[model samples]
Target: MSTSLAWESNHGKDPDVLIIGAGISGICTAINLLRHTPIRNFLLLEKGSQIGGTWNDNQYPGCCCDVWSHLYSLSFEPNPSWSREYPGQEEIHAYLKRVCQKWGLYSFIQFNSVVEDARWDGETLKWCSKVRVTGGKSEEFAKEGYVIKSDYLVSAVGQLNMPYYPDIPGLGEFKGTVMHSARWDWSKRIEGLNVGIIGNGATAAQIVPEVAKTAKTLTVFQRTPNWLVPRDDKKISGMRQALYRYLPPIRRRYRASLMDFRESWYDAAVVEDSDLNNTMRDLCAELMTKQLVDKPELVAKLTPNYPPGCKRIIISDDYYPALNRQNVELNTGTIEKTTETGIVVEGKEIKLDVLILATGFKTVQFMYPIKIYGENGRSLEDIWPSGARAYLGITVESLPNFSMLYGPNTNLGHNSIILMIEAQSRYITEMISQVHHARSNGHTLSITPSNCTVETFNEEIQERLQKSTFASDNCNSWYKNEDGVITNNWCGNVIEYQNRVSAINWKEYEITGSCAETLLKKDKSRLGRVVEESNSALIPIAGVVSMAALGVAAYLVRYGPRRIR
Candidate 1:
């Protein structure tokens, strides 16, 4: 057992796996590799100085997960002591930190080490990642930039990390304190000051109510209104927490119930005119009407013209009521431009002390700014001319031994994304297992999904997505790229995706440098052991029975109906 960071110096050998980003997907993939596979020699390079990826970045006021607290967490490591139905940013970040500590993952992580580029070395059959050690605690490294080689490269750098600032005419000239919602400055004071927040997406919905309580005047500039569903958030009682902690079965069942309820909304998300979609739209409309009954004029401004699930649906109980506050004014006018003092809305100046751009993230750019090269030094940018696509949102066509978690077409509209992350991690680990087995037999293996397989899979995904609400003609969302390609969201439910990737079809992948003879001999040796252990008369019968039983058990373990976890 080698020390984590000292592997480079002590062993003088490349790690088996190198994962980028220490966010939810990255951490989950690392944990899966540790728990499930014998490939323990792995490292995680995080650009930030912390483990929690998005949770570490976005620390804005009223920032919390829209999904249920129980469902948002890892299935293997459930937290029974959630304070509320939805966990806040601080709590989520703390949970991730605790999980990392519990798994002893800190030693394996190199903070502030930005991955500049990763190129596949065809001759060596490995990935060479160019890493820049940025100034921080990570400056302990002697050199500024260095190369780290690995047998496999897993990109867990999620889509939501990079903040997207809209191309406003004078956004750079804003004299007052300007901030993106993802990079909120906690030190900046908001009390008794006039604050103007641009964009009314999910982040804006969460920020509006909290800012309205403190700010003297809060102006929300909405380009378009999002369908706001009632969060119905509630604090967990002490007794309930005790029950969840003490009785593990109850907690597991509760999480299952949440998953089931969330999965039931898949039709609403995919089908534009589905009955469930209509029901969901009605529920959101009713919530908006009930919350803003006293302010009908504001209701007209807040109502969305697009389909319910066309854009990301926001879950907030306070957003509609917050708009009714005297200090809060919802502006639906066209923003002409911005000056040093304030923004010009409908050719009128609305002076503001603070300007907050709650403009979300670059969701379509899967792994941008990081130059990734595949076979023949073909760049990832060149491969994805239109947008990113993967065989199952995991393995690419030409990128051998490369996998991505939360890649293109994997984002969910109704259910938790943690489920998808787990599936991808498991699939990637299985691929790594094949490599490990081959290497153990004195042979190196390079695995890449065939071009035909990736193309067919993407074609099916896009064809299905065209019928979904995400690609609806009425609305444009972050889910689609500049080319109008739906690149961010999965077209099917969580269970469907899980079932699709639950097992690896080796036929779909092009495997090279595999030790066929050695692997075959090993299988034969196992069969010989089973035969030798049986009696001479019953040897044939016993061997067949044992193999049949093993096959059945494996099938049940993989595909049978079982607990949600």
Candidate 2:
């Protein structure tokens, strides 16, 4: 649980890269750097005591992933021993920790260190990050703040890190225990107590069933209803686990099948009135009708008026059944205020012993409360006053040698985000390789996407989002900002994103510095080298030989053997 003393010993020296979070995106990026790129000196600054970004934060009752366990893991390090169709929070966290341990990532991570601000030093062509060490296992560095500089800076503090609380009048006056879904308090017991929960999104759907089993009386205050579908979660048998563990091909095939099934639902998510969308809507309706057959009144209140994919579809098998309990009640009224004892809705105050806020994260604000200055002392906030924008959701226009993972317009509505993160990690490592190549020649270098490239990319994204279900006027979800701009989700399927970011387009960027001329001359040769080196581990020997042959052909077509290294 202590911070890495090795990282502390080299505090003043500059690393090759500095990553801001130790979650899935950050850890995946670090692994890619170690395995693919030649950048050895990199640091990961984590605000929490442990890794597993979302999984570590959310510990409420019934917290689990909606995605299948097999499809949700890293492609290179697939786990064949999952206990269920969908893994719970603890299992996912443990998997990440094991992956970190296997890849030796703990030595590069500094826990309990919060990044205050980071500025791109145009003169030095490096990112100077100011970090504050919060007292925990890192208490020795808590007395004062310190600065860490790196040639490249990556912001992996993802979209869903900050919790959002509704501005309800007099919410602080309540004397009972209050808790957000992300920051769960395990010591506070709600058994035999009348508990009330506000908001009815995916987290609330998971929580309602578990709390109803023990609470004296549970009241759910919902603002809007979400499309409810059957999760169909089941336990994985020991025989199946053993088969997957022993035969790697079977595990690979299983994971591929899950990914293909999930990808098939892409049309249902993006096409508002397509046949697939209608079919999914019918399935969700059938699930609600069968689950709430006895309680006809509850079914009417739970039915969503908007389209199925307007908001995130809730997958649950027990939510409706939990609502059918005699002691549970669903309130879809306007919240006027909150009193000392409970919530007041529609001129009536419902007494409660505990209150839970299931309101989700501030996803639209990609990176807030962290001041970031780019070239010529330009603030990132000033550049992105409207909303965050990045070319391929990785590099911004004004930020030089800076990249982001899981940034705007990269979140998925139907498939696993791990796929997107992997694509991004590969793309980023390739870009960093260019900078490292320049540094090895004793010349400073910085790279950023052209303003026109970012603008054109975002224009296409926004236009495509207009045709998707998420941009519907009838629904308000976390996928957008207050201005109704679709800022969080990608407009296409995962394959499209992966292919788009698979290779770096040098023409789209504005590369500068003392080595810009030399780097530009060797772009094709460097690209070929990166492709052959980075993916050698993933392919079989025959595949690698074939790829090497293809790489030589590409090199010969572009430049002669004299340019080969």
TM-score per candidate: 0.90, 0.91
449-546 per-residue lDDT for model 2 (tens digits):
99999999999999999999999999999998889999899998777787688667777889899888776665543222112112223323323333
Question: Tens digits of per-residue lDDT for model 1 on 1-565?
Answer: 2222434764467788899999999999889888977777888999998899999999999999999999999888889999999999999999999999999898788888888889999988889888887878556642556778888999999889899988889988988999999899989999999999999999999999899999999999998888876666789999999999999989987887676666656665567887667766666666666667667787778778877888999977788888878898989999989899999988899999999999999888788778899999999988888899998899997899999999999999988899889888888887777777777677888888898999999999999999999988778899998889999999887777887887677777777775644433333111011011113333224334434433443343334332200
- Residue-pair clashes per candidate: 0, 0
For each candidate, the alpha-carbon lDDT, in order, equals 0.82, 0.84
Which runs of model 1 end up more than 4 angstroms from their true locations? 1-7, 514-565
True-structure RMSD, every candidate? 10.3, 10.7
User: Model 1, residue 470: what's the lDDT?
Assistant: 92
Query: Where in model 2 is the C-alpha error above 4 Å?
Result: 1-8, 522-565
Q: Name the weakest run of 10 consecutive residues (lDDT summed) in model 1.
A: 525-534
Residue 115, candidate 2: C-alpha displacement in angstroms = 0.6
